[model samples]
Target: MERERESVSAMFGAVPEAAGMARDVLREALEKWEVRKGADDAALVLTELVTNAIRHGTTISVRVVRERDDALRLEVADGSRDLPRPRTASTEDEDGRGMLIVTALALDWGVRPFLGGKTVFALLKVG
Candidate 1:
């Protein structure tokens, strides 16, 4: 069981449990930042980002901060320069569905090279 850290905004290894850890970090930030809207979707957005990074990269960095009065920026960086592609997944397919989740929750999202790799980010609305 992982406890929530008030300041878990740092790099984490590419491990399976890191996804859950990232959620804890987002939850902590939501409370600390006093975000009142779209808080639930923000958590889901962070989870999908971190999970995708852990699947394809080595070291992972997760950060959550208020990007503006109406949005929060959640970022997950990983040691992989390969960018994500858009693909369609059938209902029974277990793969290629992460992006769908991200799209559903994030107000805006994209990727870029950072920290010797790539960082995937999402902006979730707060109001």
Candidate 2:
């Protein structure tokens, strides 16, 4: 059976609920795309991106697009123009490992300017 492709976009406040909402959106998108492998990893990345936007940016938006080639692209846009960097962290550090995990798991990922802000995206291969 051919899998159906879909896309979803949302904008939310820089609040705690936004992360949960982003996760929910990702879950729905993944289900629609029938891509189960590494879904948890994707969810984690979504949370990290949303949380970073809420914490560091004045506004945030998320977009999930499923390509005809069976690739799922997840993008998180925020008001901040600064690009994200995955830095080495001390074992004792409470945070700073989110982007590292993304870089490790995503098939491909990067950042780009969007609507006077910046958007970080990850492309995940789906079946």
The lDDT per prediction is 0.78, 0.83
Candidate 2 per-residue C-alpha lDDT over 1-127 given as tens digits, one digit per residue, 9 for 90 to 100:
5545678999998888999999999898778667787678778878888877887747778998876546778899988887888999999998889888888878888999876789999887665
Poorest lDDT segment (10 consecutive residues) of candidate 2: 64-73
Candidate 1: regions farther than 4 A off: 1-8
> Per-residue CA lDDT of candidate 1, range 40-112, in tens?
8887777778878888759888988676667678888888888876679988988887788888777778998
Q: Per-prediction TM-score, please?
A: 0.86, 0.87
Off by over 4 Å in 2: 1-5
- Report the number of the highest-lDDT candidate: 2
Ten contiguous residues with the weakest lDDT in model 1: 1-10
